[model samples]
Target chain A: MSDRIRIVVLLFPAMLIIVVLFFGGLVVGLMRSFNYMPVIGLTEPNLQAYWSVFTDQEFFLSFLLTFHIAFTSTVISSVLAIGAALLLRRRFVGRALVNFLFQLNLTVPHLVGAIGILYLFSQSGSFARLAAEWGMIAGPADFPELIFDPYAIGIIIQYVWKEIPFIGLIVLANMQSIGEDYESVARSLGATRWQAFRYVLLPLLLPGVLSASVMVFAFTFGAYEIPALLGANFPAALPVLAYRKYTDVDLAARPEAMAMAIVIALLSAVMIVIYLRYSRRRIRD
Target chain B: MTHVSIQSLTKTYPGSSEPSLDNLSLEIASGELAALLGPSGCGKTTTMKMIAGLLEPTSGDVTFDGRSVLRDKPEHRGVVMVFQNYLLFPYMSVAENVGFGLKMRKVNKVEIDNRVNDMLALVKLPGLGKRKPSELSGGQQQRVALARALIVQPKVLLLDEPLSNLDAHLRFEMRDLIRSLQQEMGITTLFVTHDQEEAVVLADKVALILDGRMKQYDSPDVFYKRPVDKATARFFGGQNFLNGNATNGQFKTSFGVLDLPIDCRRGTGTLTFRPENICVTGKTTETNTINAQLVEKIYLGTQTRLKLAVGTEFIHAVVNPAEVENLEQGQRVNIAIPPESLWVLTS
Candidate 1:
């Protein structure tokens, strides 16, 4: 009994810190969104901040753009990660070097990757200079605008480049845990190499793929630095918009930014709940 | 029809000093069950994988019914395998797992259903078609694996230590189940196992392999009653070794000189006999009787095992409990060797 009591006492500080950092912050942000804050001299709670967040034209466009970039990048990255994992499952010369290069992106910051993309795809970038030297393009004006395009293609490409390695590492770990017996059995039952992969390996890898997609989605959705650096001028991503609103000259717009933050959190929570429900149904059946 | 024939099968892994399988040759007749019995790293599983086309042989030719199958893939070889862990697809229901092969082969839906149902019934898992493998017990999962393999109606079935993962009692039950199923289906089968008892019980003929070489291939009874070499003799529970000389039908050992019931070449060699053949009695009236002290007695319920020390050598014997009632530890007893029970092996 004394040992149990001592263990609880030891865990008390860490648990309290977690509750404050996670749930407490969420509650405070949500209350601010409802305009119920005494620190800023607002006593009566209201929904004015939420209405502003919902009615802002830039907010709606940026929110949609955020969804577009995150969904596109996550889907493309997951598919490519699965392909790379399958290809590298077997042994070959210099395999360790290739795996190391793929995992190297995890250590580099997203801002650095965005800067690299900008240097490579901008108007006076190396690609445009090379195309001009090759006589394919007359001048820098002929080069396609990849960076800061209205479609967020540059941000999507950057996110995919950074997130593919993370997804690949997770998938490779899961693939290693699956035993070789499943493949052997499928082959002996008259499945070709591709057939075995399609029927057996793919089904067993579904859970890992779904979870990795969720992680990639969450990471890409909340990302601020990459989008802030690469997004279009008029309509930025939700995180970029929130950061701008929070630092506005008029302190009255701060509540709207908090509301936007709460909305983003709610969206991610809803996505996670939906994913879990679907995965549970799949496992149950 | 000859289901499987291997001519000069060999395999060498990269970075390994020696080949795993070297110049091996085997043949499995149609409707016969054969076991490749050996210890770990003895190339039993390697040989099975090559036959299944999962591993490419370095230099060899595998034939099915006189046609070379080396160029064909695993799906075209008409063979199925059951692994030791019963690798049932966790995502698929039992029925879907069993029917997957048929569906892959482009069989019609109705035919696949009938065949799947038939296989499920055969494995005694008739109503378990809707449950996933994770929801079932180990034995049931193994049965589903068996059903999945057999549903394809392949030319041959390969079983790699299919019962090693079960408990002792379940192992026995599954052993009998597999044997009965094999006899019923009559599909040419090749089973790999390290357990000598399992091989002897389930195989019509056992091929004892060691170090990438075939030591002996014969029926279990013959392999036990008359082993060809010292290693084969020792592997089949032949525990007693007597330094003796054989002349026609008689062997002269330290205990006594006795005549065997059969004739052999006249030579100076060693004689081997099983422990069960050496009887122990209270009196020394029999021929070839040596008086020795009982070293240990182990009561095995049905039979009591006794150890006797004669000079510098110790001998083991199993006797009926009724005959060993008076036998006690450290008691003097007479060890009798019947003449016809002794077997002679050269070198």
Candidate 2:
């Protein structure tokens, strides 16, 4: 009993910070989302903000755009990360150096990566100048519009570049711990190289890959800065749209902004719950 | 069944000066079980991997049924190896792991299930098809690995110290199971072990390796009777050695002159007699008898180990405790050796 009390005592400080700052903010925001802020003379709780959010067509478009960004980034990053881990697991000349370079960008902040992508892939960026100098394009306007475009290409490129190493590092460690023995045994049992990788290695690696991709998906779904910096002005990502409403001059827009934030958080939570269910089922299988 | 032959196989790993396996050559007849016995790092596993086509030989050829299999990949070689740790797929159940090879070959589901069930029965793991590999005990996991390999019906089976991870009683059980299974299936099998006793008990023919070199390749009985050299004799538990000069079937040592075995080489060498072969009696025999005083007596449960000394030379002898019930330290005793029991090791 004392040991349990000691553990709880030791955890109290950090847990106090998380509970007060995170759940405290969530509870306050949830109350305001129901339009029950007494300071603004709205003492009666109401669902008007959620009703307006659901009735708006732009909110639906923004949700689809956010979903597109998160899904595209996750799928592309997962495939590229698996490919990188496979190659990195093999021995080669200067393998340690290659592995170091592969994971070097993980320490970089996502905002910094987003800015780097904008500088490289924007209409007036270095690539446009290069194409102009090479006579491939007449001017900066002739370069393809990849930044602040309808497809959200620049934001996705930034996310994939930043998230690959994050997912790949986890998968590489899992592969190294598993070692070559399982594959060797598979080969000895008359499995071809591709068959061994597909049947034996891929299934073993799926749980790690799934967990990492879920985290990336949730982060991309609710992130604001990358989309705010490099998204279409009309159909902005959900978080950017919510921040826009929160900063509106009209005070009634605050409740709607809180409702949008709650919806985004709930969607991400639902995805996490689904991922947990899937991984648990895989383990049981 | 296929005859397996490893012809002059040699392997030098990268960045290593010495070869792990030095020009090793052996041939196993079809449906025979051969053992590669040696101490750790003596190239026993290296030789097994070379034969299994898991490691490429520097300059050699491996043949199966009189055809070269050096160019064949490990998957195409039809030689399955059971690892020491029994690397069953952790995510797979027993039935899936056993039927993995056949699944790769695209065998029908019905036949794969039938064969997997039969293989499980043969390994005495019936009705364990639903359990995961992690859910089973160590011995059961080992049987699943065996069943997995045997379900493929490969041309040869390679066991790389498969029972080294088991407990003593489990090792005995697995040894008997492996022997009966190998004989019943009549598969050409090669076993690698660092244990001399395991090699003797499980192999039809034993190949002794020492320091990346072949020491002897013969039946188990010959190892005790005619070891190639002093190291071979010592490895096989030859405890008593007398440095002597042999001339015309007679060996003269510091203790006394003794008749050597008929086929012993005539030279300045050492003669070895197993401690169990050195008889202790109350009276002298016809020949090869020496008087010694018991220096120490160790009371083991089954037998009493006696340390006897003639002048300054000491030797150990093991006798039944009942026979030496009255023997004590500092007592004089008669030690005798028969001529046939003495073998000379000229090294």
Question: Could you tell me how far off, in angstroms, the CA of residue A209 lies in candidate 2 after the best superposition?
Answer: 2.0
Mark the regions of model 2 whose C-alpha exceeds 4 Å error after superposition: A1-9, A135-140, A275-285
What digit string (tens of lDDT, one per residue) describes model 1 on residues B242-338? 7778876788777667677565545777787778887877667886688888999999999888889887778888888888798789988888888
Candidate 2 Cα lDDT to native: 0.90
Tell me chain A's TM-score in each of the predictions: 0.91, 0.93
For all predictions, the C-alpha RMSD in Å is 2.9, 2.3
TM-scores, all candidates, are: 0.91, 0.94
Candidate 2 Cα deviation (angstroms), residue B162: 2.1
* lDDT value, residue B134 of candidate 2: 91
Best model number under TM-score:
2
**Model 1's TM-score against the true structure:** 0.91
